[model samples]
Target chain A: MAAKKRKKSTAAENEIINLTNVCKAYSTGAPALKDVNLRINRGEFVFIVGDSGSGKSTLIKLLLRELTITSGYINVMGYDLSKIKHRKIPKFRRNLGVVFQDFRLLKDRNVYENVAFAQRIIQKSNKEIKRNVPSILSVVGLAGKYKAKPRQLSGGEQQRVALARALVNQPTVLLADEPTGNLDPKNSWEIMKLLEQINENGTTVIVVTHNREIVNAMQKRVVTLKKGVIISDEEKGGYIDED
Target chain B: MRISSFFYTLKQGFRNLFRNKWFTLASIATISACLFLFGLFYAIVTNFAHIVKTAQEGVAVSVFFDDGLEESRMQEIGELILKRPEVSDVRFVSAEEAWESFKAEYLGDYADGFTENPLADSAHYEVYLNDVSMQSALVTYLESLDGVRMVNRSEIVATTLTGVNALIAYVSVGIIIILFAVSVFLISNTVMIGISVRKEEINIMKYIGATDFFVRSPFVIEGILIGLIGASIPLGVIYGMYNVVMDYVTTRFTMLSTLLSFLTVDEVFRVLIPVSLGIGVGIGFLGSVATVRRHLRV
Candidate 1:
């Protein structure tokens, strides 16, 4: 019984975030989440897949403190999500990088400056930006496109620039919301490969996707939500109904 | 972040202002026209007052003694005029001395034609009154005195000067009010446009941990620079026009012997420095606060 308890304690030690009865509802009288419970472990890659309006984005937003929890406890990186101040959101966000489906690159700035903007907000030194941005650009295969503006770049290249900006500060957790939604199959696979490489470097990554092919290929722990309730939490889970 | 980023934003603000040149030109045009009109008004008021003061100084009463009046009687009348509260100074121009001066001045080379100086054989009492308006009462008082032939105080000139001075005071107050309203309207709109254009940038900056003061300072500084620029165009124009008007007044009317009453050339430049700075900095700071209050979240 002592050995069994030690194994259980070790399992608990791997958990980075634990959510208890988390619920999020909109003011317009529709429940977006209903008593949802989730656990994300340290150094784990998580793919949250669901149908439309299944509370995937809401879950990500809740974790980021962009939306407050309606009626549950969410302890992420040691801070209670419901009780966090609006001003303290950035400090929490500093530990995480968020990538959106639309590839929100600052159009007025060139690729370097676009990436530099995030670092500037965090008050990174010029020496650090000089040291890190080049390596980050190289990692995202955007070395030669530093001076190029977002308008001048192709969709794949722009997405890569966005990825570089997200990864520039070396965030511990990467939350990608349909990161390759606008990319071609070839580019999508390339981005997936890059995400896999990043995950391999010990950063916990959570990807929300509607693309079944990429979701199936990732071969990670998948949490499937249906009508704001977790229907399945499976190891090495593929697309929802694959035999 | 370092305070240098604020400087960076200021540089960006100026660059943005210049980049949008059609807007800049429109602003500059309005500013220039306003300054030009303001300068013109100032010059008119200045010259008007100068003319009035000159007329006032020149409107003295000449007390011509009766023909062959005794020197003692003339001295008594001079002493009496001097004793009056309204009189500032009294000088005596004797008939023979006055004739020789008039011969040399007005008669010129034709002085020999007059066998006798047919000018009145009288002592001219040059009377300086304390106020030009008081000259009428003073003339009445002088005429009431014994042995006084005429009291030559120009009532028409005094009345005209009083009317002009009143008009000048009214117009100055009106122009200043209009100019103030125009400047406030212009600077507020300019700052509002700037805030609208940078709405996204401001949002991103705010979210990125920039303090409220950091985000607002650049806009305030920008406003001040813009206002300074707005007022500076007029400052230069006003100074230049001051020189032109000073030279014109000095050349045309030396007898009035008046300096530029509004401002001298050097003083005009000196006054412009503070007035322009005050208008520019004050308007800029105020407009920026108003703009930021409407736009910035904090």
Candidate 2:
């Protein structure tokens, strides 16, 4: 069964996500992540910056519970990552939202249906889905394009549809990995602005990206990685390419 | 899971059943044909067994008396046979009575066409045994009797029929097993195609926290529909065709009907219905579950 929807959890001031000395090593290669320690409290906007192979994707994967850590502890929303049952991983994932670079929308489904799918997975009633889908679409500026298929929409609109899908559940933490990678500069700024608004509304947001200009402009707390280890963590830090 | 979720998966499965028209049709066609052949073989094998069983039931030995024996002597012989431990029933039929029964049963109006009763040496003790396996020993004892001229028994016919029945059953089972395996493989491949068609959607679903059961339900539902439709076609066809053939054989081919009786379609489907439906649905579920499990390991 799906887990219960989470409460705000802000009153207790609990850390929403925690990773301590985490390590992930594949059999054929060196460690993808080494001794990574990080923590984020409620309603903070953070960015994870790294070059290719610097383990940004690996960190995102670890937080999503898609990859088992080789060692050390990771916890999110009071559930230990190592102790969570395999069948309950999906229930754990519902506490957070996820977005991707390519905007993974079901091509056969329209914008509204795409966003509503997340609710349907948790077995929401038709009445509830009806009430929630339109409101979420309005949040992502897709209220009038509910019937448009993925191929029929522009790239940014498709990403918006994906964002709507991710946010429809009102997740406590929003994890966006290269969300604006496929968009032009103007579209990228709009997506960043939306993420900023979402963070302001008492939700923790974590963005992983390679876009240096957008990172410098946002001046968010940035955790930079090099050679499978954290080199710097700072509040209001800009993306320094040379590390 | 909620009731609404159950309905959603069911409706999803129904809609997906028609998603790829050609693939669904092909799978159903193959399944129906396989099931039809299975039903046909079942009829033939069961009828063969029925005929063998009846022939075994009717097995008996006849003890005939000498031509010069007095009626009193024949009566003593009949009494002796009646006293035997193996004999279940012993009834004496005289030459005249035996001839009359023969003419009435085998000759019909053709007996009137004949002026004389042609069967002269038909008198005997029609002895039924408690067990067919004791027939040989009884025949030996009767042959050694004083007034007995001959012993007539259908042991050879019964033995041959029983053996043939066993052979038919073995061969039919072997064929059915091979055909069933092939049918299941074809069903698995069909579901595999459906999974491949929606790989991207499936990946997205998994990432968004759709459980394995939810992700797999639609395909399973489609599999069940295919199985249901596939089995019903052959069941209907075989039942109707069996009745037609049974009517023709029982009416027009009287001689063959006596020796080789076929099962009524109703009788055959008593076994066929469960077997066919089980095969259809079992394969469908197995295929879908296996494909989904392997494809969406996350």
Candidate 3:
């Protein structure tokens, strides 16, 4: 029995994120997430899909520790989201990379600076920044456009810059919230491809997206949420039509 | 808190200041105006206090002797007066010297009118004290001595000067408190505007795993710089104005210069420099810290 318990503990330790019956309620006393239990392991690529007000953003915020859970537990990268001290939140977040839907790149800075910004936040040495930034820019296929500002780049190129920034720190997990919401189909596909590439490279990628075509075509694990409850968890799944 | 991070935050702080140039300039101007008034009042009060000190030093108690007091006994009394701790100095004026001085002053052209010394019995000891406040004590002591006829003191002058000094101190403290508040409020407003302008940038920084110290350091630095720059401008202005005013007072008001001497620029700035800079930096730091705590939740 002790050996079996050790094996189960080791399995729990291997999971990058574990949410056991987690529930989150806002000030209005309405439940945003209800009895949610899910787990994503290392190097896994998973998608969280839900309609508006379906607790998708709330789940993301919980993983980021932006919101405290109303009940149950959330463990991200081994840090308990519910019990993590306020001062340790930044250090905890450093292990996770986040990409927003709006492509939140510093407009005044160029591609190189924007990518280097992530490295700078971690206080990387100048030599490391000079080395790592260009290497990451190259990975994002924006090495030649290092001097171009955000406004000078296309929507696809800007998203790529945001991706470069998110990946520069080599985080254990990459959380992309509607990362392709503002991009065209071609750009969105390119971003999804990059995310898949990043996951294959040994980073857990959890994306919250709404593009039905991309979701169906990707053939990845899909976790569907309806009215703050997980309705489906399927392997190689597509977007479930609610209508 | 690595040295590299320190430098980075320092660079960000300067960048923030330059990015919001208008707000920076406005804050500096406000701080300068406030310090300028404070400096002006400080200079006036210091000079007033100095003049009062000189006047107090000159104040003395005139101790007259009894009729037919011998020269040896008067000398003993002078020695006794000199032994008092509050007595700074003592000058005994003989009846002959008194008559001579009186004639030299009121009877300059009628010196031959006084054939003999009519003021022979007016000999007295002028007792100079270290502090004007000790006049009452010394006066009482002198009046109680044998062969001492009367002890006359400038009580009204001492009281008025002491009152004026106290009033100046109270007013200075009150004005300084008000000015400091106004300066802090202005700096807080400027920092608030800077924060609003960079709200999006700040949000991104917070999202990107930057600590509260990492994010707040730049604004705090910006505040300190504003304070330093703001403080320095008025010191320079006051330095020049002080010299000019001193020159005008010495040359333009020659009559007043003999009775009252203003402090040299160096003497004034020796205190003003540190105080103004300290206040400037203090206000900046306080304003930035307070605004950051209130507005920047992250």
Give the TM-scores of the predictions, in the order they appear: 0.66, 0.81, 0.89
- lDDT tens string, model 1, B30-126? 5556665665666566657765776677667888877778889988998999998878888888888888888888879888888876876655999
Candidate 1 RMSD computed on C-alpha atoms after optimal superposition onto the true structure:
7.4
Q: How would you order the candidates by TM-score, starting with the best?
A: 3, 2, 1
Runs in model 1 lying further than 4 Å from the true structure = A1-39, A48-76, A79-90, A221-243, B1-192, B206-225, B241-262, B282-298
- Error of model 3, residue B134, in angstroms: 5.7
Taken in order, the candidates have interface RMSDs of: 3.7, 1.3, 1.4
Tens digits of per-residue lDDT for model 1 on A154-240? 888888887888788788888888988898999899888888898999888999988899888778999998889999998899779
Give the TM-score (0 to 1) of chain B in model 1: 0.66
Which pairs of residues have clashing backbones in candidate 3?
Answer: none
Error of 3 at B140 (Å): 3.8
Chain B TM-score, one value per candidate, order as shown? 0.66, 0.70, 0.81
Mark the regions of model 2 whose C-alpha exceeds 4 Å error after superposition: A1-13, B20-23, B50-59, B63-99, B102-151, B236-259, B295-297
Residue-level lDDT tens digits of model 3 in B68-159: 99899999999999999988899999899989899888988878866789997899999988777778888889999999999988899878
Give residue B288's lDDT in candidate 2 (0 to 100): 64
Best by TM-score: 3
lDDT tens digits, residues A1-243, model 3?
A: 999999999887789999999999999999999999999999899999989988999999998887899999899998988888878888888889999999899987899988888888888888899999999999989999999999999998999999999999999999999999999999899999999999999999999999899999999999999999999999899899889
Better of 2 and 3 by DockQ: 3
